[model samples]
Target chain A: MSDKSSSRSSGFDRRAFMAGAGIALVPLTARAAVQDPTQAAAQDPALPVEVTLRVNGQDKRLRIDARTTVLDALREHMGLTGSKKGCDHGQCGACTVLIGDRRVVSCLTLALAAEGQEITTIEGLATGDRLHPMQQAFIDNDAFQCGYCTPGQIMSAVACVKEGHAGSDEDIREYMSGNICRCAAYPNIVAAVKQAAPDIMKG
Target chain B: MRSFLYQRATDPGMAVQALSAAAAANNPLTQAAAQPLAGGTTLIDLMKLDVMRPAAIVDINPLARGWSGIETGGEKLRLGALAKMSDVAAHADIQRHYPVIANSLRLAASAQLRNMATLGGNVMQRTRCSYFRDTSYDNCNKRIPGSGCAAMDGVNRMHAVLGTSDQCIATYPGDFAQALIALDATVEITGKSGTRSMPFAQLHKAPGNTPDIETTLQPGELISAFSIPRRWPRSVYLKARDRQSYEFALSSAAIALDVQDGMIRDARVALGGVATVPWRAREAESLLKGQKFDDGLARRAADAAFADAKGRQHNSFKISLGKRLVARALQQASTMEV
Candidate 1:
C-alpha cells in the first residue's frame, strides 16, 4: 500500500529542496541566545524542528521544517504514502488518519504537534497480508472506482464505526460525508461501511 | 507555506509566556506573530494558503488534559475551550441538556473535522469567503485592511447580509458559535495578565471600519472555557445549506425557548452564515418572549430578526432565507420533545 514511487514522482526530495532553498537548520534552543530575540526569531520562519512521531507502533524521528504537516511527514519523510492529499486544506478528507482513537485530516495537523501520539495511516490498518475488515469490505462492495479516496474513506469509515456512528445507512452517509469520493463512489462506500460495521463493532 | 518555529507548551502559563513575546506587536489578531495551535484546522489550512504567516506556533495540545472537559454537573454548563467538537456533541449530558450546542457541532464540517476541531478554535475559525482565503485576489478587506472587497460585487452569494459594512461582508462560518451566542455563554480567557471573563457575544467584532481585527482579545489571550448560565433542553439548531451534510450553512438559526404551559417565557435567537458575527436576533427574541408559538408569531419574529439585514447584489436572498430559518428554528424549538 506504500506509494514510494508515487511520492518520488510527485516532486524533489523535501530535505534536498529545503537545503536548496537556503533555509537554516538552526537548533531550537539557539533562538534564545540572540539579542532582541523576538525580532530575530520573527525574521526566521524557516527554522527546522525535531519531532519524534510514533507511527504504526514504531517511533520515527524527523528533523523537518516546523511547517510540515502530518501528511507531508508521512508521505515525504516516513515513506508512508497510503494517506492521499486530495486537498491540502481540511476541505477534503483524503489525508485522514487516526491520531490516537479519533480520525483527523493529516494535512491540517502539524507534524511538530503530533509528537508523543500514536499515528495510524491506512498502511497500518492491515496485519501481515490480512486486510483490515474495512479495507476488505471496500473491496467486496466495490467501494472505489479510481481508488484515489479509498485510503481516506477506509480510515474515516473505521473511525466512523468505532465512533458508533455507523448504526444506519443515513448515519454512515452523514459520518462519512467528509471523505468525498470524486469518482462518486458514495453509495458503494456507504455499503462497504455497512458491511464492515458489525465486524468492526464486534472487535 | 512559510516556515514557523513550533514549540509545545506543557501548561497554560507556558503557552501564554511563549505567545507573550509576539503579543507586544501592534499587528492584527490574524497576523499575530505567535499563534496558539489547538486543532490546527484553521491555522494550518490558512498557513498552507499563505493567508496566515505567524512567526511562531505554540502547540497547546498538551494543555488539553486540563482544558478538554465537558462538565455538566454544575448549575451552569462549563465547557472547556479545548474540548473537541465531536466529544462535546456526543456527550450524553450535552446532547440531552444542550441540544442546540450538540446539533450545532454535529451539523458543522465533517466527522473528521469535528474530531479534531476544538470548541475554542471553532469559534475562532475564519470565514469561508473565497476572496479572503485565496491570496491570488489581493482585494479582501478582511485579509488586507483598506485594500478592497471583491466579494462586494463578485460572487457575493456566500457573503454576509446582516452585518455588512462598506469595508467587508465576510460571514462568520462556524455553526457552534451561533449556539454559544444564543445561550448567552460567557467566555473565560487566560492571558499574560492572568485571566478575565467576557460575554461570548462580544468576542467577535463586526466588520465595521477595520475588518482585520476580528476579535477583542488582547495579545497573548486564549479562550480557556465557556460558561453557559443554564441549560435549555427545548433548544434546537436548524441549518439551511446546499447539501444535507458537510457544507457551510446558507442560513442557520439557533433557538432556545423557555415555554411554560404553551406560553413563551423566554426566547433566545441567534443566526449564523448570514452575519459577520454570531448574530443575536434581539428583536425576534423580544417578540417571542410573551407570545404563544404559532405560524403568525413565528413569521413576525423571523421578519423582525432580518428587518435590519442589509444584503448586496448576490446575497439579498439570505435575508429571506435567514428569516425562514429563524421561524422554522423557533417552531422546532417550541414543539421539540424536551
Candidate 2:
C-alpha cells in the first residue's frame, strides 16, 4: 500500500515537472508580460489582422496577431497540429509546409504573407482513409523510430520526388537535407523516398 | 516578436514611402524602426530573438511579380533582387555561364530556406555571431552600440579574420555576396527619390568603430536588382564548412578567371567567411593577371589575399584555411571546362 502511494506521488511529480519544463521554453520576460493583463493590452499590436489562408484545400479565415506565423496559425487556431514546431526559428525543418507547390519553412513565414497561397500541411497529404504513397512507403521501409520528424520528412520527401530530386540517393539526400531527422533514420528514409518516387511521379 | 503594423507594398514607390514614414531613419539599418520584409528568414528570426525590434514591417513581396526575374541576355546577366535563391541556383544559364553564382547559392542553407529566401535578403543577412543574435549577451556592439564585445574573449570560432575592427570581429556569413563581388556585380537601388546603381562591392561596410551601421544604403533604399557584366564561364565558388551541407562556411573562395590562350587576361578573387564584408582580394587578382598559371603563382596570390588577415584566439584557423581555399579555387577555375 505504501509502495503504490509513493509510485502515484512520483508519477504526479513527473507530470508536473514536464509541464513546468514546457512552460520554461518561453522567456521569463514574455511570460511575465503575458500574465499581466494591463501590460499585455498595452503591448499588443495595433489590431489582430484578419487573414484567410487556403490551407490543405480549405480556406481558414482567422483574425490573429499580425506577428503570428503560418506554423502558429495552423497549429493553434486551425487545430492542424500535424506541422510540428521543433524549433520556432528556421533552423529546424519540422515546420515545413508546401506553399503554392514550393516547400518552405512555415515558422519564418508570416501568416499575413501567406494569405493567398495554397498551403499544404502534413494533415492534408492523404485522400479520405487512404494514406499517401509516401506515408505507406515510410511504414514499409521502417523509416522512423520516434515519429516526431516523420511528418516533416514525409512532406519534404513528397516535394523532393515532385521536384525531380529523387532520381538518386545522393539527390534525395541533398534535396531533403532541409528536414533533419533527429532519430538518424536516414538510410531507411532514403529507401522510403526511393520506393515512393516512381509512384508519386507517375501521378 | 514585437508587433506594430504590417503593410503590403505593391509598387516600389509605395514601399519606399512606407519605409520612409517610420521614425528613427538615422538609426542603423538593423535598428531601423521600419524594415522591408522579403523572405522573412532573417528579419523574423532576429525579431523573435529581440535582437531587432522594427516597429513597422513593409511586405515587399507583393513587388516580386516585377522584381523576380532572371535575364541572361546581351552583355549583362540581370538578376532581379526578389528572385528566389533556389530559382536562381537552379537556372540553367546561371549554372553554365556563372557556376560561382549557381554553386554559391546551391551550397547555402537548405532547399526549404533557399526557396523562401530572396537574393536581396541573402546579401543583407546579418552575421551568425552568438553575441549579436542572443540578447542575453549585452556586450555586443552590433546589437547595442558602445557595449563591449563578448565574442572578443568568448568562443569565437566563427568570427572574422579580415576587415575586422577593435569594436567587432563578426564574420559576414553569406556565400552569394562573395560571387557577386568577385564578378563585379552592380546593385540597383530604388528609393523615394529614384533608382540608383552602385558596385556591389561598395554595398557592405566593414565592422569599424560603428559596427551597428552595416550597409551603405540610405533610409528607405531597397535593392531592386543586380547586374553582372560579361559572362564568367570559368568561375567557381568553393566552401569549406563544419558540415557537408546546411551550414555556413568556415572559409570559402570565389574565383573568376579570364584566360586568353595560355595566359591569364584578368582574374577576380573574393574571400568569404573570413571577412567582415564581401572581401575582394585585389592584390591576389593583380598577382594573377598577365601571369601564367602555376603552383608558385597560385601560392603568391593566396599569400597576398591573407597578408593583412588578423585572427582572434579561436578563429585563427580561418587565416590558413582561407589561404588554401584561394589557391585551390584558382587551380579549379583555371582547369575547369567552361
Candidate 3:
C-alpha cells in the first residue's frame, strides 16, 4: 500500500511539474502567438500580405496587413524594437533602416513593398557582443542625450560614410539632417558620424 | 488605417487590367477604391492620417525589372517610372548633362526618403498643404469638393501664389517636376487602351474650378517613363527654403540656357513653391531670350515671371521671394561652365 501510495505521489509530482512548466511558458507562447503573422492571418482574413523579409541575416516570413509599415513590422511583429517610432510620419527619421546598401525611412515603407529585400536595423548593427563602429562612435562621442534618434542616426551615418558624403563637417550635417535630434544633439551627432566615417568606409 | 486588398503584379498590363476590373465594379470617380502603390511614402502617409482611404492597392514593384532603368540613349534621356529618386539623381550622365535635374532631386525630401521614393511617385505627389493633410479641418476643397477652401483665409503661408483659383490654393510641392517642365520632358503613360505620351507640363492640371482633379491620368493608366529630348549642360536649380536641407522649398527655380557668343539662343524656366502647378514661366523665358544675361535683364525677367501673380494675405512674401529666385537662377544658369 505504501509503494502504491508513493507511486501515486510521484505521478502527482510529475503532473505538478508539467503545470508549472506550462505556466512558465505562458508569456513566451503569448508573444509568439501575437507576433506570428501566420497565426494572426489564420484568426483574421483581413490581413493577406505574406511578406518574406531577409532581416539582418534571417529570412522572416510574415503575413501582415498590406498597410503595415516596415517600421511596425520590425518593431511590433519581428520583436526588434531597436528602431523607434518617433513621428510615424516620414518627417522623423528615427525609424531609418538599411535596405540592401541604401538607407530608407522605414515608417513610410510598406512591409509588402519590402518583401524579399535585405533589411538592417539598429539591432543588426552589433556582431555578437561587439558593437558596430558607428554605434561605438556614437557612444564614444556621446552623440545623443535622450538616445531616441541614435539608431536612425547610426544607420544614416553608415550610409552617409559609404556614399562618400562625410568628407566635411558641413556635408555630414547636411546629409544627416533627415534624422532630427529633438534633444538638439546636432554637434555631437556630427562628431560621432565623422569619427566613424574612416572605419566604415574601409569596410 | 482601414483594411484593404493587396495584389502584386508580375506584368504591367495585368496590373492595369486589375485596376480597370476593380474600378469597373465600383465608381472610380466617387470611390478611390484601387490605387497603384509605388513608393508608399505619400499614399500610406495620407492613409494613416485618415485623409486618403483606399480599399485596394496594386503593388507595381514587380514591374521594376523593365521599368526601373535609367537610360541615356537615342539623343534623349529615358527615366523609368519605378527608378528611385536618389538613383536618378546620382546617375553620372544625368548629373553631367542635366544639372538642374540632378539638383532638383538632390534638394527634394531627405536622403532616406529619396532612396525610397520613385520618380513617378515624386511627380504624382500631392500638395503638402496642411489643411488637406490634417483631417481636423473640414473645408479643404481638394479633399472634399465644394467644401470650400480653408486655406483661402486660414494659415496660407505655404500656399501657392500663382496659378491658384478660388477653389484651392495648394502648392505643387515637388522640385523634380519643375526641372521636368523647364526641360520640356514628355511623360510616357500606359493604360487599358495603349501607350500615350504627353508633355510633362500637361501632366499636372492647375487648380481651376475643379481643384480635386489634380492629374489628367485615367483610372487604370500608369506613368511608364519620362523622356527628356535633349540635354541642358548649362543649367542650375536654386531653391530658397526655410532651412538649407531636408525641407520643402519656399521659392525654387530650375533654369537651362543655350548661349552662343554671349547671346542667349534658348532658355527654359520653371518655378516651384509659388505656383499651384509645376509652372513653366514662359513669360520669364521670353524676357530672357535674345537679351544679355545682366542683373538688369534678369530683374526685368523676374518681374515678368510674377506679372500676374496674385498672392493671398500670408503668402504675399512668396511673390518677392519667387522673383529673386528667378533672377538668381538666371544668373547662375548663364554663368554655368558647360
Candidate 4:
C-alpha cells in the first residue's frame, strides 16, 4: 500500500491546491479540493499526511490529515462525494463502502489505515454510462426517500447480495440492518435487494 | 482527533518493541500509553469522540499473517487475534462445533461492523456506556478515574446490575467474550518480554475501586490468539435487546451443556449485558449437576445465577430479564441435537 515516491508529490500538490484555493484562485484541482468553508475547515485545518488508496480499480494518491476518515477522504479530498457520512460514527451505515470486497463503515475507517486497500465507493459501482444493476433496482423500486443514504444503502445491498444474505425478506432485513433508512422505506429497500439479488449473485 | 504518530508494525515483535519504546519514554506508569490498531472499530470511534487518547497507534494488521487463522483441527480450537468476526462466525467448523461462539459474534454488531471488527479487538473493545463516551458528562469514573459515576444515580437502565462496584456500574458490552468465558478459552499474549497465556476469564478485572484499570494486561501487551480447550457442540447464545438488530444487549446468555439420559452431566453458564465483566455463573452451573434438564431445574439454576445481583432504579428489570435469558439459553442448549 505504500508508494514511497508518490507520497511526496501528493503532499506538494495538496499544498499547491491549498495555496491557490485560499487565494480565491479557482484552479480545477483547487475547486475540487475546497467545496465550501465547512469542507475547507474539515480538510485544511489539520496536519496533512500522504496516503495511497487503491480506490475502485485505480491507485489514487492523496494528502490528508491522520484524522481524515475514508469517507471524508473520498468526499473531501478525492471529490467523489457519493458516499454519505450520516452519523460520522459506526452507528449509521451511510458511510458504508467496499474494502477488498468486504463491506465496512468508511466513517470509522481512517484513510491512513486504508492505504493499499481496494476501496469501491458508490461512484465506482457503475461502468462508463451503464448503471450497476443494484443502482438500477433502487431506482426501479423507488427504494429511497430523501436519498441521503442511497449510496451507502446500495453499496451495502450489493455486498449483502454478494455475501448471500439476501435469501429472504427477513434475511435481507437482518443483513441490511446496518444501513438504516430514516425515511422508513425498508419495505421497498428489501424489495429492491430481493429484486437485485439474482443478478448480483450471477456476477 | 488529536494528531498522533502512526506506525505500521511489520511483525508482532516489532509491534511490541515500538509500544514498549513509546511507553518507556512517555508514560512509564500507565497501560493506556500506546494502543495497537486492529480493526480500529472501537479505538478509532473512541478517539473521534475524544474519549481515548493514545500517544501512538501501532497498526497490527500486518501481523495478521502470524495471528489470523481459525484452526479447528486439534482437541482445542485455536483462533488468531486478527480473524474478522464475520469470518470466524461463518466458518463451517466453528459453526458446527461452537455455535455459542458463532452466534455470539454474529449477533453482537451489524454485518458491516462484524466484517470490519477483529476478534482480539472485539474482546478488548470498551463499553457503550453513554456516560463514558460523552465528554459532556463529567462524572464518569471509568473515563476520568475519580470524578464520579453518574450512571449510578442517573439513567442506568443499560448499566450493570451484577459484578458492579460502588465506584462504577458500567457494563461489559461485547457478546463474544461471554462465549469465550463460557467455553473456558485462554488468551495468548505477546508482550515486550515474551509470550504468555492466561485464562480468558482472568483477562478482565472487576470494576472495584480502580475502575480505570479495566484489564489485567500490562502496558505494551497485545493479545495474539485465543484457544479453547474443547468444543461445546450443544451450545447456544441468546441475546435480548431493545431492538431486533444492531443494538447492544439488554440481557444475554451463553450456555453449553453436556447431557446424558435427560440429565445434565456438565454445564457452563455465562451472563452478558448485566454484569461488569463477562460473568460466569459457576453457582448456577453447579446447581444443574446431576439434575434433570427440565424447566423447573433451569428456572432454579437461573435464579441461583442472579441471587447476589443488586440493581439500581432503572436497571432492576435486567435482573429479571437476565434470569429469563439464563433459563431460555439453558433450555435451548439442553435440547440441541448434538
Give the interface RMSD values of the models in order. 6.1, 12.5, 16.6, 13.7
Give the worst 10-residue stretch by lDDT in candidate 3 chain B. Answer: B23-32
- The C-alpha TM-scores of every prediction are 0.94, 0.91, 0.90, 0.91
- DockQ, computed on Cα atoms, for candidate 2: 0.25
TM-score of 3: 0.90
CAPRI quality level assigned to candidate 3 from its DockQ score: incorrect
- For candidate 4 chain B, which ten residues in a row score worst on lDDT? B24-33
Which runs of model 4 end up more than 4 angstroms from their true locations? Answer: A1-47, B24-31
lDDT of 2 by residue, B38-68 (tens): 9999998888777888877788998999999
Q: Write the per-residue lDDT of candidate 2 for residues A1-203, one digit (tens) a residue.
A: 00111222443454466567673322212112112222333433434567889998998788766777899899989999999888777887888899998989998999988988999999999999999999999999999998888888888899889988898989888888988888899999999999999999898
- Which residue pairs come into collision in candidate 1? A45-B3
What are the clash counts of all predictions, listed in order? Answer: 1, 0, 0, 0
Q: Candidate 1 lDDT, tens digit per residue, B205-270?
A: 998999999999877889999999998999999999999999999999999999999999999999
Least well predicted 10-residue stretch by lDDT in candidate 1 chain A: A1-10
lDDT of each: 0.87, 0.87, 0.84, 0.85
State how far residue B84 of model 1 sits from its true place (Å): 0.4
In angstroms, the error of model 3 at A136 is 0.8
**Which of the predicted structures, 1 or 4, would earn the higher TM-score when compared with the native?**
1
For every prediction, compared with the true complex, DockQ reads: 0.43, 0.25, 0.21, 0.25
CA shift of B95, model 4, Å:
0.8
- Which candidate leads in TM-score? 1
Instruction: List the lowest-lDDT window of 10 residues for candidate 2 chain A.
Output: A25-34
The segments of candidate 3 whose C-alpha lies over 4 angstroms from its true place after superposition are A1-45, B24-31
